[model samples]
Target: MKKIRNFCIIAHIDHGKSTLADRLLEFTKTVSQREMQAQLLDNMDLERERGITIKSHAIQMNYVYKGEEYILNLIDTPGHVDFSYEVSRSIAACEGALLLVDASQGTEAQTISNLYLAINHDLVIIPVLNKIDLPGAMPEEIKDEMVDLLGCDRGDIIPASGKEGIGIEDILNAIVERIPAPVGNPDGPLQALIFDSVFNSYRGIEVIFRVKNGSIRKGDKVKFMATGKEYIADEIGTLGLQQIPKQVVECGDVGYLISGIKVAKEVKVGDTFTHIDRPASEAIVGFSEVKPMVFAGIYPVDTSEFEELREAMEKLQLNDAALVWEPETSAALGFGFRCGFLGMLHMEIVQERLEREFDMTVITTVPSVQFRVLTTKEKLLNISAPSEMPEPNFIKYIEEPYINAQIITKSDYIGPILNLCMDKRGILKNQIYLTAERVELQFLIPLAEVVFDFFDKLKTISRGYASLDYELAGYQESDMVKLDVMLNGEAVDALSAIVHRSKSYEWGKKLCEKLRELIPRQMFEIAIQAAIGQKIIARETVKAMRKDVLAKCYGGDISRKRKLLEKQKKGKKRMRQVGSVEIPQEAFMAVLKIN
Candidate 1:
């Protein structure tokens, strides 16, 4: 490879990675008059809706700097910490990363995390200041911070305005000059590393990989190193969206080739692909595993749509590898998926996507942390969903998951933020203040504590001025129980959580009623009670179904009566069918609402 450059653009959620990608596409003339879109790589509606890049999109562009053509494999990686695993994996596919700091907002928590990730990988780090054209633009000051934090020379910092299309060529030159060209054997037997793979009904599986040591031709037999599965490459190509056929997706280049494989997980992200005769280096990943900290049960509000719910989850999991699911049987809710997510954001995104994309309504359980407990008979169990927990009396000891969180915010917010954290059973770790008003507070909080309402609480307390990032600290042996919510003497599976002993009563008072309001008015006065064995600490009432059951169902006309009955049935079916009462999705989401 003569002049190859592989790098990913990293920034905070709204610091303009996609905007920069759009300018690059326009600068290189990659899209003609008829092919232009504002954010070309952000092809998904959700990506544009959130104003954040969700997936790591890659595009190849040719830039001529002074007369030399350098191949720029530009990777736009997701910036949210919820997708940190994806960021790490995407960074692994590159030799360098462009650190995009918001000139106005300075360095965010995610910028620090991404910078640390790139440094940990020993990849060349190039700092660039983005959004310089904004009202609060402070490129020089931000550049100084970058020089101090990232150890970059003053002149090395590139001032850019992705919105204004300023300094695009300079960034291009810096990429070619600063980032080293990828090196790998191009003549050996075909071996490619799969960064991502997607399933298509027509194409079967579109495998995205960086060819490392060999060239893969169309119809070549290749084996996935991790799974020892081999398949014939139906077609070899690179994706700038549409397929470019007959192109050799060689070393230092990112491309998507097709294989007649249907299982999505078989050729997982970070798996290595090579010819059956001789494969490339075995697959290696920077991250050991993707651990989903937040787990919930997703059930259909209309119980008859069980198949629709399953299909919705399957389609949702295709684009999100962090999402894990399997059929979960709940005595109260029948059958549903025990879905796992990286965090609350990941969970919400999945639920919203299922509703918006699949057009299916679902009732989601309050998110919970995994627990480890032992029965009196000495049988150890790992409990994910609340239904998996052992009977209350038969349990000996329980260790619930915990995460150490660090919040960085202005000094003005310390009092309120600390109060919010402490109320959630956060053990005050320590606090340190920097030169400016910025402060960092560390807390050891139960994973179940901050698992659901943490972010929203922070936003409300600080008026959206604080930034938080947390990783799983560890699981400690403690008194953990599956607090169950009983509606009219019957347990509702979606209202359970792994709560600590001390805070159960308080959380139950707030959460049980929350679940009641979430459950619509039922036929009879339903008592929503959170109980531990025979003890009930908190209670609420789901008032008798009064507003519903329209009088029109009894109209004298036979045909009109039939239509009225059908409509009433349709509306009632939207509510939960716990024993008998229907539960609407709006009611399901209301349980999780912080307000």
Candidate 2:
């Protein structure tokens, strides 16, 4: 099947990879125009809600250009840097990649990184300049940049608007001409890469793969090319979202398989699968392990939802292996899970999916970096969530993870962007002019310091013109402490925090104000204090209610009292109650919220 060509689309955020995938599905008549949904590959509700690809997706299309039916497997990868590991795994599944560069935006860092990964994989690279129909699309300029930077022909630019279905046929033609077809012994040992997988109650785990050689069929005994774990292929099919049972998945074909696999970890991404008859000696380790660079706690507002939260995480983790979670107990939150994720966006996506798909509400702790803590006694503890951090005095040395970032923007906005980066405790590494009007600034910044609201702050300061790219740097020893927040002598788990010594006053004062905004008038005065070590650095007062006496039950309506109590009870679930009134989650969140 060496004559078969396989490829996927790679692009930056908002560069229209999914938009183009939808158009291709329609253009090739794989899915009818009537059913064409914009960003259709974003099948998960979370992806649609967030407007980003959190996981990779593959769809096979049988197109007849002449009299011959050619099978085209289109792999769609996530564009964000957080999912960089995922992008490379998807790249490993195919023989070629379609590099989509925004016509107006030119080549950003990710375009460069992904292009480099594809090149390293030895895949045939076809550069497509997308969004050409929109204004500010400097197609020629972008094309020139691609040739100069990527070493591709100037005429290789397939200018197309995936939204408007322009130059699509040419894209398909390029796939046929430029990308070499899948080739190997179709009769040899079966080797396929598990690029992505999903779980179904009825089917267990459904794994997707690009057949590198030989064929896969139902009832065939297969082993994980990497783990050497064996399972009988109960069924082999194509993923049209659900399994479409097919007779055989020959080499060069992209299909989904069910091995009745119960555990998600065994059939890991980049793990190869082969028949036992001609099992490969070693499993392919084409993909890298996904490690969560950021950690937080996901506590259900109502503790009863803990199991449901775990279930939701299980389902979500099937698609996103990078999202990590485990059972954890907090004095304030009772039973909850400590979740580790790639970044802030990843954390948000998980929460959104849990809320939307599973219909559960969760309170998340402030984002924290995993610190390799060295205690005065030489103990090692990997601390992430603020509440889980060791006592300030016990920590002899603390090392925090940092990232090297590239910020590209207009020349006029460089100063403000640089200023904002420094404000986040960033160390400027270098600055260079990418073009006459644009500049790129490099910085080494602690991941935790910039996790929560940095992107929003960046957009606000740069007028949404700057594009930032970050890759993890080595960890460094830093002085840090967890600042506990107390409201009327009760510790708020959500308000507990990790902070720098010098910014305690500022952070605490700002947190006190934020707590005030979150805490409503109560029956008793609430004293909110932010303290580092043993000293209180900031305080706020929420005076006892003057009028909420509810002086009278008012009506003969007992229902009104019940409704009021029920609503108040629900809100109190997220808040700690003192005497007869309740506090809020913000009181906890405020410990970290700075002015």
Candidate 3:
């Protein structure tokens, strides 16, 4: 155990974490040069295309130093704030972390957030200044920032460049010397923490875990602490380029256990696995269940594919425990599933995967945050979709979730960023100057505001230099009301949204204008109105299409033409009184894009 090190790499997005991992794999000779690829740990095609890590991956490497063999287990974690929960879980399974900071960009919002997470996990954090080979690299300034933020000695910081393969040996040596070895009782009852899981069609559910205590072997009967389900371990292995089977995975080691459980819901991320015959007395501490923050309805464009979409979601849930979904029907979009996700990026990734991998085309409703509703009779209910909301008279009040948001950016663009935040009803919490050029600002904003295009706007206002990170700060009482879109006297449930009462007029006006552009003109005029309760706050009309009813009356009497025109006008009046508008799919999608 003295020669074994279990650690992970944590960083902000696009900071070369995966590149550094690739270099480490090369130096450790884990994969041959001929078979190596870029961002080896980022196995997902979407991750590769987007240049981001979406999932946590673990790999075991063997290295020899000073004539002594050492076992190093490196777990690569996602760098985005949307996957912070995955980062925390990965940190919990390790003994140390390599804090990678870009020498050019220095510290970012997510970098600070990940550093705190590593500190909370009580892991040995070895700060590494990466990308020293870049033209804009400033190692001295980045070193100072790291020391100030981490409160560590200047001599402890290591400088390296992932692209140039510089300082690779130094990083390896530091991992061996600075990071402590994992300490656990091999003789104790079996206890392992499941950090992640994947579904295999033939092998059942394969769980990736860290052996906190005791050992697991093939054919062992294991029980999940949370679910109390027993399954025989079909195989035990370590993750290489592929699964390398082993007879036993001892304590203080990271590996995969193949349990003969075909159902994904049977296994959870934070659950503990123990030998059924000699189970541990208690489960490990700090087991946090993943919660969904944003909710939306996903409907198949072809209603016949509804069951296919449902099956696809079920299969996806087996792999992504963070995903939650249930059957839902929309008046406009028809039957579908209301799905919950960690955030907007997660929601988008899921949608993309469903389209690309499952070959299913789907229509997604506007995303919403879960709201707490208090009824007149003093009943409390949770609502995820606007359609789920009770009548206006039945509710006493509503509470919306809020987040503690932190942003890091240069000082030059503070004015526009502040204005943007204020427009979103943000309440400033605190501000700090990280350096002469950079500033860190905090705010308490509604989660609904941040989940939608807020990050994109922040980047645009700050010239793509701003980084944001946020945490849920619980729900707060606010003056929020449901804003409904009415088309030809009918309320479109899919277009309904909850907004702050103060901004209702502006939002209603903007929504009405957007719908007018999206909805096509019909034979009769279509009145597009935005309403709060029964009162219309904004309205726009799509003029009826005109037809020359008397164009074919050439050489006929003028009176004949007049009679034909009068008859056509009466027909149009009747059509206006009884005709219902048919909104196309493009209009539904267009309204969702309205900011």
User: What are the lDDT figures for the candidates, one per model?
Assistant: 0.78, 0.80, 0.89
Best candidate per TM-score, number?
A: 3
Name the lDDT of candidate 2.
0.80
User: How many clashing pairs per prediction, in order?
Assistant: 6, 10, 0
| TM-score of every prediction relative to native | 0.90, 0.90, 0.96
lDDT of 1 by residue, 121-234 (tens): 788988888888899887777787788788778988888989899988888888888899887878876667777666576867687778766677777888888888889888
Off by over 4 Å in 3: 545-547, 569-582
- Tens-place lDDT digits, model 2, residues 1-595: 6446689899878899999988888878888766777788888876887788988888887677666777788889999877887788888888899999889888877787788888988998888899999888988777887887778788887889988889999999889878888876688788887888888888799888888778898888988866678998888987663458987888778898887888766767677888888886666566667778788888999998888888788877877777888888887778998888887877877888788877889888777778888989999888877776777778888888899988877789877887887788899999888778777888999888777888777778778777777878988988777788887777766667777777767888888888788888875567888888678888998876544424467876878777776765555444535354355666545544454
Using lDDT as the measure, which candidate wins?
3
Off by over 4 Å in 2: 65-67, 225-229, 240-243, 263-266, 546-581, 586-595
Off by over 4 Å in 1: 302-312, 515-523, 542-579
- Candidate 3 on 347-462: residue-level lDDT in tens? 98999989987899998888889999999999999999988888889989999999999999999988898999998999989989999999999999999887788988999999
* Candidate ordering by lDDT (highest first): 3, 2, 1
Model 1 scores worst on lDDT over the 10 consecutive residues at 546-555
